[model samples]
Target: MVITDVNEYRLELARKMGVTRAVNVAKENLNDVMAELGMTEGFDVGLEMSGAPPAFRTMLDTMNHGGRIAMLGIPPSDMSIDWTKVIFKGLFIKGIYGREMFENLVQDGGADSVWPRSLADHYPSFLYR
Candidate 1:
């Protein structure tokens, strides 16, 4: 899997974690990297965790038709994007507010995992009902 980050340290960490490719966005162009990797069709899947409008826009621009995106980061304010890209590309963007309760997690047996339990216990009023 390819991972992109502005921080060199984080890119290094991703490399250590065995990502197929790790890019430092501060120094290199993402599209150039994609072209070098022979990804002429663009990315098939994208996880948007930065919450930056530019990053999100780049993700939208660099996605292939029928690409799936999971947006987990919460933007600080309102932003705009090219709706034509979404319409013409037929991109599937799912906005994930917070990881409280989700059927997918239960299906994957992650609901019973210690991470969710810890989150629930830490934020009882928000997560635990």
Candidate 2:
């Protein structure tokens, strides 16, 4: 997996975490770094952990056709993104909220329960332990 950050030291940390490539956006272009990995076609899945709008856009710009993205970050200020890419690439974007997860877990009566069918199906052990 490729990990991108604004910190060089953070990139080193990513390298230690079994990431195939770590990009320091402070020093390199993400697309250029991705190209160096022989993946000009882009990534299939992107997890937007940072709430920065640019990070979200970066994920969108670096995804391949039929790529999917899940975002945990909600930026303070709205930023414009290239809608053309979303339409042309057929990318799927989703927002994640921890409250919803907790609600589903509680309503479902533990991880073993099946009330929230989608959650249990996608992640059986998310709230199991």
* Number of the top TM-score candidate: 1
- Stretches off by above 4 angstroms in model 1 are 97-129
lDDT of 1 by residue, 13-123 (tens): 666656678988878899899988888798987889899898899999999999988888776677899999999999998888454336655776644542334423335
Q: Against the unseen true structure, what C-alpha lDDT does each candidate score? A: 0.78, 0.75
* Range of the 10 consecutive residues with the lowest summed lDDT in candidate 2: 113-122
**Positional deviation of residue 15's Cα in model 2 after best superposition, in angstroms:** 1.4
Q: Give one digit per residue, the lDDT tens place, for model 2 in 1-129.
A: 787889776566556545677887877898787778787598987878788888888888889999988776677765688999899999988888668655755875644432334334336676766
All predictions: root-mean-square deviation over Cα?
A: 5.5, 9.0
Q: Which segments of model 2 are wrong by more than 4 Å?
A: 97-129
Give the distance in Å from residue 92's predicted Cα in candidate 2 to where it truly belongs.
Answer: 0.6
Clashes counted in candidate 2 amount to 0
**TM-score, prediction 2:** 0.69
* Poorest 10 consecutive residues by lDDT, candidate 1: 113-122
